[model samples]
Target chain A: MLVIEDLQVELAGKTLLKDIDLEIRPGETHILFGPNGSGKTSLLMTIMGYPQYIVKKGKITFKGVDITHAPINERAALGIGMSYQRPPTINGLKTRQMVDICAKTKVDTEGMARSLNFGDFLDRDVNAGFSGGEIKRSELLQLKAQDPDLMLFDEPESGVDIENMALIGTTIAQILQKNPPRAEKGKPFVQQQKERTKMGLIITHTGYILDYVPADKGQVLYGGVIACAGNPREIFQCIGQMGYEECVKCTI
Target chain B: MYDLEDLKEKARQALDKKASFGGDLDLNTFDRSFVPHKYLAEEEICAIPQEEQKRLIMSGLDVTGHGRGGTYFQKDTSVIHCQSKEEGIQVIPVTEALKNHDWVKDYFWKLVPVDQDKYTASALLELHDGYVIRALPGSKSVYPIQACLYLDKENLQQNVHNLIIAEEGSELHIITGCATSPHVKRGVHVGISEFFVKKGAKLSFTMIHNWAEEMDVRPRSVARVEEGGIFINNYICMKPVRSIQMYPTTYLVGDNATAMFYSIIVGTPGSYLDIGGRIYLKNRGSRAEIIQRSISNGAHIINRGHLIGEAPEIKAHLECKGLLLKGGIIDSIPQLEGHVEGVDMSHEAAVGKVAQEEINYLMSRGLSEDQATSTIVRGFLSIDIKGLPEALKAEIDRAIDTSNKDSM
Candidate 1:
């Protein structure tokens, strides 16, 4: 399980988020919705332990360990991984080598890349000249190799074209264990849920991903705080009908 | 072809003339007398001391001669071992070739001027033994020929002049390693090399330098390419040297000729390197490219590149990139000259430390900070040469890997 309590975050001496409380147990996937500059990415970055995101008064726990002050690599080693929206390009490092680094062991990088339609780019430098959709596939391919317990996706569908949307969405579902195996198709719902241990927190702007991946809950972040929480589909419908300002007003 | 007496007079006049760059060295402070060693057979090369063999291997000289087409081993001032195992190739000492072969007279000092600087003049006045490697026409080498210039005499100035030629319709590859004995601390080396690429031929020469910390090295080299010919030059110097300076030049004299120069350098503390490459695209449809990578670790390094396009429809480019680590000075100079309106030329030069964002990105993939930095540094030193053989590429990678371990 992953938990955050009273998470107050500051960046570059300016407060970006405050009084944030969130939790996601095993087999649970949550969706985060917010307006521009509403501390959505900041909340995710703070949880990932980026040194730039200073925790003024908060604590983050992952798998029963307090990790509010842990370094980024330590958190990564402890089954925490994130897919960045605009990761920097590392020259001279082949994507094939990067997959091995993420795995920390020998892996079938070529097989994994073929599944993501990224086999051709495995020999190129990491993100040296990748297009928008290609970058997304590269990031997801690394996360697949990592196989972390806690996965974070920041705007997975922002720059994706319509053709790649389904591929990206389905891959995310498979990574989070939202899709049950063929043998478990006839099992009872309770038994299947008990077997799912992967956890996910996805930040989406268009809500297009909800059509492919099921979300257990959704929350609205306004003024650096979670203003409302409800069913994922209902929250999307309400936000679509009325602007974020109206929703925040009614919840407050 | 020319008068030897007149050439001697020119060399005497410029014996004391200072070079255009780098720190000056007093020529009178070192010994110029010849140091002789017994001839070594093919098997005897492996019998050399283990420590000395290790240093030679690091510079890409295979003492066992397993995959080499030929071997030329020069110790101090004499050719201790010179032979060609492959058919269509000839490896002989420069002094012997000039003394016996009539064809050698036409090539000796043909491309490189003898009075360019004090070092070139010194090579002409007190010329020691060097190699003359040539490829027969319409023939190809099965493996690269290996050459080693080993300095074992202390405080001795070794003057050498080398000539290489690739005849028409032939392909040749050469690997030369220059190293010093483990016990020899202080010395000077002056080398003059001239290269000729005949029509429709291809030639690639790779040189690796592994010198002692107190050694001063000056090498003068020039190349000329005929019509439909190709020339590839690679240079790598990773170990420490007190001071070294060289700027090799290549001329595309015939139509559709091509030349490419790639260099990788690492500067350690108390080391000063002034190295660069210059190419002249003189004919129509000629092309030239010069790419250099340099890293300074508390040393002073000056990286220079120049591309000159003298005819219409010619193309040229120059690139120089440097990384400053552990408080050192890196001066990168890239120049492009287009003498005609229809010529195309460009240049890009950058010098800075590794970007932090690149490091942080790697860290997020579960690598520690130290691992991330070294990965970036290794990548920074790796360059993809278009036409290099797989064996040579592997050799370059091994050199970079060893240097990365020491630098980090």
Candidate 2:
């Protein structure tokens, strides 16, 4: 579980996010709604400890440990994973190669494909020239390999085509359902569930994200504050109608 | 006690003082009759004309003493010596190997002519390529053969011809070099080398050249690759020289032949280094690759690599990248041309400074800003050392490591 208490972020000499508060727990998905440059992506990147997003104030505690300034790899080691909106393409590095790297295991490549629906192009360079849908699947595959304690999704629905949305949504559910529980050395059944790896913060912008991902709570972040909280469908309909700009105006 | 310039002056004077060490002092047969392009595509259908076979004789001499408007002469091999029993494992002067052993002299340069031009042949005859090395079948020498040449005098014209032959299934590593050591006047240093590879043979040639201040060093070399041969050429230019224009060519004449060339040119304040490799797929089903990376700071480095697929069923790839910093300049020109359709050829080039995003990503992984940048730079260079010989891999890594440390 991770908790963000009034997080304030500033970058490139500009105050981006001002006093934002949120929390994510195991087995729960939280969709953060905001428009471009409204600090939506910055908040996700900030939680993942991107060095460029300088946290000017507030505190971020992961599993009761204050980690507002932890290094990226350190955070990674602590099971904090993120799916970038525009993932970086690792040239000359193949997709399966990255899977092997992050998995740190000889993952069942065939099974992984069946799960993510990308069995045809595992040998190609990592995201070198992937389609929109393919890129989204790669992110999901990386998350499965990493199995982070806290998962942050930034616009996962951007590339999900209508034909594959249901499959992708189901694949994610399967991953969450088939969780190996928290890994504990030399422990069986009960220890496995204790390993209960977590997936928490789920951010989406287009107002159409949770049509696939059933989240614990859907909150609106407008003008750098929690503008509203309600059912996923209700919030989707509001943003679907007025957009985040009107949401901010209504917050006033 | 010998500064690079001082050494160059001495080498020039020693040559003028007369060839003290007698190695190969005969045969300056020149080929006045140029082999026209018509003759080029026309292989020896029947023992190439007597005139053509006569031109193929393994000798370093051209008539009238000049080759292709360039000066030509044999080298003085006295600089070479057996430091210990290890260097003598299978090492022999190229010319000596040719005269005493008929098979070596007859078959070595038979493919690649030292006298591809008039002066080269003339120079081959004069002093001969100074030294000849014969790594017998299955002979793996531990110590590198050191071929040192000095540009002794200023304004003096010198042409040094050399030959190396790696016999069947043999492994020979050569650390051939030339520098403007102290005593050598500010002048020109032109050194040429030609090598032959027999079946199943492997050779690692490391060439490191540091020219004296204000001196122009020009080196030209060629290697003839045979069936199942592996030739690795790693060239490093650490210091700035006036004008360095070199194009080392590898002819893959047999099937299943593999050749890889990795070169790094570090040009400093005021230097111009134009270096690259040419791989000519002369036979079917051959494979070759050339990777050239140059790092320049306040200098100019030009890397031009070309893969010429002369025959079908060949695979050739060329990748060139230039990393420039501190107002330095770099020009990368990579070309892959296939005459035949069955060949797979691709050439790409990228010119850049260290990517900021890559640096940041690496830094976020517990590396300092400097550490991150160097790691990315090293990754850019750690490309070809994967399948190289252990010694070569180590040397390449060391060079890159040193460069990384220095940049930091």
Candidate 3:
């Protein structure tokens, strides 16, 4: 479970996100939808504590603990994992080794890689020479390896083909099933980890992932604010009836 | 400078005598064994070369004996050359270490042989003070015996011969560093170092060379690894030594033997460095690995490294990467060739500028653009900083950090 209160991100002296508030409950998949440059990826990076994007005037809480200023590795160790839109290639660092390090001995690599179809990249450098799909699979393998309680997915379904789309969908669903959210009463979302397996906040411009797994909430972020929130299916239907451009025009 | 008359007179005086002690050497002990002989300097000539004795000098390598083109340096000159002394490493000049430590002395001759050229042979053969170094069976030491050679005017042609012997099961680390006094005159330097590692021996050698910016340097060195022995050589070049050309060769002659070479040749504007390493697997079960990294700016660097596995179970590897900053040119040649089966040999080479994404990402994280660029550049150079000893690795890390901060 995670909470963001009036979160704002500024980069290159420009406000990328502003006045954004979100509460992710344990065991629920929150789909963050937006058009290009809608601050979706920027929000994910802010949550993960990437140094570049200034927090400006926001607070991010992971499991009720303010992690607005945590470093990337610290966030990772705290059971927060983010699969980026574009993975970094760190030469000489083996992918398997990184998974092991991320897992912190929580999970095994062979099993994670096997489940994610990355047998060939076990010994290869981390994200080096990896195809788009391979990078996604590697991230999934790491996600499973780390077995974090909170997962942030940035365009996880962007580069996946229809064939692997099914695989991706299946794996995502399985992971969702593997870590159901906590539903305890009278406990803050911060301590919800004791009862829940895992929770996730996924960002995507295209609603293609709806073809695979059900999303609990579909929210469109414009001007760094939630313009609308509803069933992912209806939200997608709205986009279908009214193109993203028209929706943006109407919102502005 | 007095040349042929003086050298010939010395050679005639020495060679005319008979050898009552052909190979009687004092092992593990220093004794006076200065065999006065002609220090040859030829335009183009051939003579069966022998091991050299280099004297260690800590200061004064410039002021070559005075006046234009002189052959002699003052006795107290800060210049340090090989010396034959009753004290010092195993005494009696390194050239004769073979007789005292015959089994190990065989490797003393070609540390980096003085060539027929201007500096290679002259700086080595003509220098009067030199030392003979030998490591006996199972012998290991802590500190690196320091050796220095200095030159100035016309061309400081000094002959330096160094020998390192790791007898069976012996372990040793030797340091050969060259430096010049501030604002010293420029000259040419040709030096040779040869080492031999016997069965089960381990030798770690380091060469830190910082010559005058206007000097030309030629260094040729080699080592032979015997069965179960390990030899690791590291070279660090930091000064803007104008032109540098060196080829370090190693022969893995024993089964299950290992050799590693780590070299960093940094050349600034108006500088050129042709530096590399070679490993010849002449026997079964031998292995060698060569890794070279070069950073050049407004200069040219040519690096060539190769690995050879001669027989079965022999393993070898080579990795060379060059980083070119504006106006820098790099031509790298890495090769892995051998007939030995089951030999794991690979050579990877890459050339590129700083990664833009990494820079942008770091800069976004509160780091300045310069800080971002340097952080990534240091990261590139710190690739091997990971598996080193904690203290040494920390030192390396500190250096990178300092460089990064300075750039910032």
Candidate 4:
């Protein structure tokens, strides 16, 4: 579980996110929709405690502990992980080595690679010459290795093709420990007992990931603030009918 | 052909000319005649501490000195022991080889001409002792021939002229190590190595140097590859040295021949190093690759590389990279020359401090800041050397591991 109250963030002396509030309970997933330069990534980076994301006035609590000014690495150790939209390329560090470092406990990396279909890239430089789909798969693979309780996905479906989108969607669902929508029909009774303990806050613009990852709530971020909160499906339908400007007007 | 007297006179005359780009050490200020010619008896060899002696030997040489193919141990300027088991293979002292074998004169000092610089000239004129390895035509051996050159006394100068010849269709590997005792306060080492790879032969040479902070080292080397031959050179210097200046050159004279140069240099406090590699693709279909990696910590390092494409259809590449930890200076230069229209030559060089993002990424994975910094530094120093035997690779890996530990 995570909570944020009145989080006003500034970058380079310019206010990016103003008076923002967000909360995610255990076993819950929240979908955040915003246009370009609408402070979607700013919110996630702020919560992750990036030094550049200056929090003018706010408090962030994770598992009943105030971690407002925690270091970036400290937040990562405290069960918080993120998949960046564009990760830096490390020249000499191998992909498998990075995965081993991320997995603090013993992990079957070969098995994980097989599941993610990235076995050939295990020995290559991290994200050096990867395609769009390959980079996404690598990010997800590292996140899986981290095995954090709170997952933050930044545009997981931004540049993925339709074929790889299905795989990314299903993996995101599994990471959240949620039953797939396709498996919702004719599910076994024993399968219903699967524990759902992980929480997620995913940022999306196209809303394509909603088809794969089920969200309990949706919020519209406009003008550096949360404009509305409602059901994900209903909010997506409303945004499709009316542009983001109309949605902001209706919410206000 | 010049006789021995003529060559000696030529080298003596060139001893006054300094190298174009010199290091911090000035050989003129020191007395080169203070060196003593002391023989290392069996008991005296064992008198040196085991730890210090072990540091002088290559990583994979754990067996006794007289193990497999051959082993040569030299202290100061005298060859203490030399042995060989295999037929058609000769490992003898250079002075003895020059006197006994009439054919040895044809290959000695032929590849690495002594009149190039004063350091090389000094090594040729004032040479003490070194090894001469010869593999007869069509002979093949899997075991590596090992040699250890060490300085044990103060104010000593060990100038050696080593020659290695691989006849046509032969394959050989040479592993040499150089070190000095901690008590050697003022010393100078000038080593000259010349390698000749005949047609269709393969030769791999790996040298590891661990010297004290009071030593000044100057090594000059040259290799000539004939038709359809391959040459690989791996050079590493991990410990602190007062100054070192070396730039080994390789010439590919036959078609379908290839040459590779791999070097890793670590500069500690109060050290100055100027190391580089030069390769010439002189024949059609000849290829060359030069890779240099350097890490500077409170020291100064100058890394240089040059590739010359002289014939059509020749390919060459050069790469130089440097990592700065604390206060240090590193100058990396990679030059490319294409004389023929169809030849391809390119080079790349980069110098920068370690990225904060990389350290933070590692720290996020449960490693502390120090651990993260060490990990990145180690990765930066670990280069991928292709086409080496598994055993040789393992040996190089162990030496690299030792270097990493000592660097920090």
Candidate 5:
């Protein structure tokens, strides 16, 4: 669903990501592994078309259209959504109002909020005084309301507790329409085996989210370049034992 | 009739004193009161078309006499219309009430004394026509009495003295709309309003003003809430005006008395608005809260809130928030004074531009930049005042929305 070719990104004359190339097909989830300040967020922001993330070179093609210079809202309209690691707080804008704006049509916001156990926060200002878990859930709540085709998760498990992690994991699975964990009572799980066409690119530092998300492919990004490509679990084990320097040496 | 010789002398002396100058707006041109040769009579009042009056009053209030209440209309110095739909509620012209009833004159200028300021002095001495509203003892009203004071002729000075009395155990709501003709070149309005909330009574007052750019407005008001009584004041100014300087004070005099003041002021281009709220907690268990939000777009705005805790067990809070758009200036001052032990007082003030991250966040949710900016501005101007009727809340919301669009 998304393809990036030789993407070189810069901010304030400093190169962040250089010669980055990646592609995610339909029904595929890509796990991006990197260390701190390894340009994981810059890649996602570059794809999302934030004005400050200057595209020095390369083009981002999404759903067969090159949106390299598209505005932020234009990208959002074209089925691109993101969950920020640390979203800013809006003082007077209500959560429900933001949800309403995200929805393409009339949406059952209360029902969605209830499903996420965020009913009490519907009337509060967006992200104002929210805990880390609550902020992650708020981002997920907005993504759920938006129902975008291409979802980008920026460290979903970074600041989440175990209890909330399980809830968020289940909600993310439901939103991405991943294969259900198990069938309902008196219902077969075979129905969930049908085509799952939602595409996602989730950035992770701890690899804790692999227990919930079934990633098809994993790639380590070292020094603003792709270091290696393999199974996410295998790459996590390799990084755990050999460290990122080993992966960079192998790539070189 | 009482002796007026001393009062007239005081008014003459007050006229010599210059207008108070604490606000940041430049009002050299309006330092002296704009005195007209004569106010228009009932015949000349027709110069203001009926459509303009409808636009100012009924368009914003959405009142159709569904419940029991009254309506008062004044054009310049004439009392155009006054009627009461329920018994035990007196709605009459201030002069008429003073001529017939003894209590009207007693409390007319009592709460807001004539010597309070130059504007009050001018209104009391050169005042023309105003309203005297009274909810009798033990009476309760589900609907609000509506009043519209419109400026019709150019260069007309509309000085009014209004008195609202809610007797013991009575409850009433008053909505007053002050506006001028859209094409009015120049005018001056000095309104002195005094409210008396008797023991165990509740009074809610909402004032909405829409003025042209050439109009100057000075509103001086004071309220006395007695024991076990409650008072709520909602003030909104959403239109552009030359200059407006007002800071109404409320005194919680009796035990367990409470006051809440909510103000939402929007300053359009080239307009200068200096508005504030003050409350004094005088007795034990008295409480007061002042919340004000100011939005300035290429205009100058000053939001000031002051609270004083005088007696033990008294509590007060003042909150002021200001949003400055491009080329506009906003100064927020929140002050709290504690006079006695065991008295609590707090204040918070903030002034800044809208957050760019907030705007970008909204845009990522499918809204255009303009849409996102307007939504935040509208929300910033929304003051969630407690104890207001749902209908009045909706009215205030509509007024805020209109102002947001107009300013944009």
Candidate 6:
């Protein structure tokens, strides 16, 4: 489980987010919806322990451990990982090698890359010249290799073309354990649900990923706070019918 | 043929003249006296002292000669071992070549001027032993020929002149390492090398330097490529040295000829390294590229590159990148000149520390801060050299790996 209470984040000496509270139990994926500059990404970055996102007064607990001040690598080691929207290019480090680093052991990088249609990019420098969809796939490929217990996806479908949307969405779904285990076919639904231990928090703008990933809950961030919380599909319908102004009214 | 007396006089005139760049070293402070070692057979080379062999191996000279096409081992002023295992390849000491081979006179001082600088003059005046590795016409080397210039005498100035030639339609790969014995605290090395790539021929020469902290090195080298030929020159220096300054130049003299120069430099504290490359495109369709990567760990380094395009339809590029890990100075100078309207030349130079964002990106992949920095540094040093043999590429990677360990 992951929990954030009374979160007030400041960046570069400016308050970006404040008075935020959230929780995500195991076997659940939450969709984050908000207008631009509503501090959605800031909330996720604060949760990941970026250090630059100073938590003025808050507590972040992950898997029952207080991790409000943990470093990025420690957070990663404790089964928390994030797929960046615009990761920096690391020259001379092959994607193949990056996968191995994420795995922390010898892995079938080629096999994993093939599954994501990224086998051709295994030898290239990490995100050196990747296209939008390619970068998304590369990030997802790493996340799959990491196999973190709590996964964070920051706009996974932003720059993807229609051709790759399904691929990226399905891969994200599989990583979140939303897809049923193929080997456990014909198993009881309750048993399958009991075995789904991975938790996910995805930030989206278009909500196109909902076609593939069946997010259980959703929240609207308005004025640096969670304005409302409800079923992800119902929230999407309500936000589509009425602009984010409705959320602002609800917050007021 | 050139007059030997005239060359000697030119060298004498420049003997006391200071180089245009780099720190000046007084020649009178070091010994140039001849130091001789007995010729070592193949088996004897393998049976040498283990400690000394370890030093040589770090510089990429394997005493076992397992996969080498030839071996040339010069210790101090003596040619201790010289042999060629493959057919149509000649590994001869420069002195012996001058004494016996009449054709050697044609190439002795042909490419590099004897009066270029004080270091070149030193190599010409007090000449020690160097190698002349040549590939015959239409011949191809099965494995890279290995050469070593080992300095064992303390405070001695080891002067050497080397010539490498690839005849028409032939291919050659050479790996040469220069190192000092473990006990030598201080020394000076002045080396002159000239290369020739004949028509339709290819030559790749990789030089690795491993020297002690008190060593000062100066190497003068020049190359000429003919029509339809290719030349690849690589230089790697990772260990600490008091001072090293060298700027090798290549000329594309014939149509469609290509030349590429790649170098990696690492400077530790108390080290001063000034290194670069220059390529001149003189004919139509000639192409040239000079790429350099340097890191300074509290040492002062100067990286320079110059590309000149003189003819129509010529293309050239120069890139110099420097990373400052510890407190040190990195001066990157890249120059490009296009004299003709149809010539195309470009240059890019950057000097800075590793991007924190890049480090953070790696850290997010679960690596610690130290691991992230070293990974980026190693990647920054790794360059994909075109046409390099797999074995030679592996050798370069191994050198970078060992140095990465030391630097971290």
Using DockQ as the measure, which candidate wins? 6
What ranges in model 1 sit over 4 Å off? Answer: A185-187
lDDT of each: 0.90, 0.63, 0.63, 0.83, 0.82, 0.92
Rank by DockQ, highest first. 6, 1, 5, 4, 2, 3
Rank order by TM-score, top first? 6, 1, 4, 5, 2, 3
On TM-score, the candidate that comes out on top is 6
For residues B173-257, write the lDDT of model 2, one tens digit per residue. Answer: 7655555435444554446667787788988777666555555555567888889888888787665566677778899888778
What's the true lDDT of residue B22 in model 4?
54
Docking quality of model 1: it rates as medium
Q: Write down the C-alpha DockQ for each prediction.
A: 0.77, 0.12, 0.07, 0.47, 0.63, 0.88
lDDT of 1 by residue, A29-70 (tens): 999998989998888888778889999998899999999999
**Which lDDT tens digits does candidate 2 get at residues A1-252?**
788888888899888887787877766667777666677788888887888899999999888888899877677667677766676654444567556655645678768866778877687665768888888888788777766667777777787798878776655655554332335476786655444456666667665546556666777777666777767666777787887667555543
| lDDT tens readout by residue for model 5, A1-252 | 899999999988999999888998877888999888889998898888888899999989999999999988999999999998888887777899989989989899999999888999999988989988899889999999998888999998878898788888878877777745575574545544445678888898888888888888898888888878889888888888889888657654
Which segments of model 5 are wrong by more than 4 Å? A181-194, A241-252, B1-3, B22-50, B57-63, B66-68
TM-score of candidate 2 against the unseen true structure: 0.61
Higher-scoring candidate on TM-score, 1 or 5: 1
Cα displacement (angstroms), candidate 1, residue A237, comes to 2.9
Q: Which of the numbered candidates is closest to the native, going by highest lDDT?
A: 6
Docking class of 4: acceptable
Q: What tens-digit string does per-residue lDDT give for candidate 4 at A1-252?
A: 799999899999999998888899888899988788999998988877777889999889998888889887788889888877877677777889889988988889988987988899999888888887788888889999998888888898878898888889989899888755344567664455344778899998889889988788999898799988888877888888897778767765
> Which residue pairs collide in model 1, if any?
none
DockQ of 2: 0.12
Model 4 local distance difference test score: 0.83
lDDT per residue (tens digit) for residues A103-203 in model 6? 97777899999999999999999999899889999999999999999999999998999988998999999989898456567788888878889999999
- Candidate 5 chain A weakest lDDT stretch, 10 residues: A186-195
RMSD of each: 1.6, 13.7, 13.3, 3.2, 4.0, 1.2
Task: Tell me the spans in candidate 4 whose CA falls farther than 4 Å from its real position.
Answer: A181-194, B24-48, B57-69, B85-89
DockQ of 3: 0.07
User: Which regions of candidate 2 fall more than 4 Å away from where they truly are?
Assistant: A1-39, A46-218, A221-226, A229-252, B1-80, B83-89, B94-131, B138-160, B175-189, B210-215
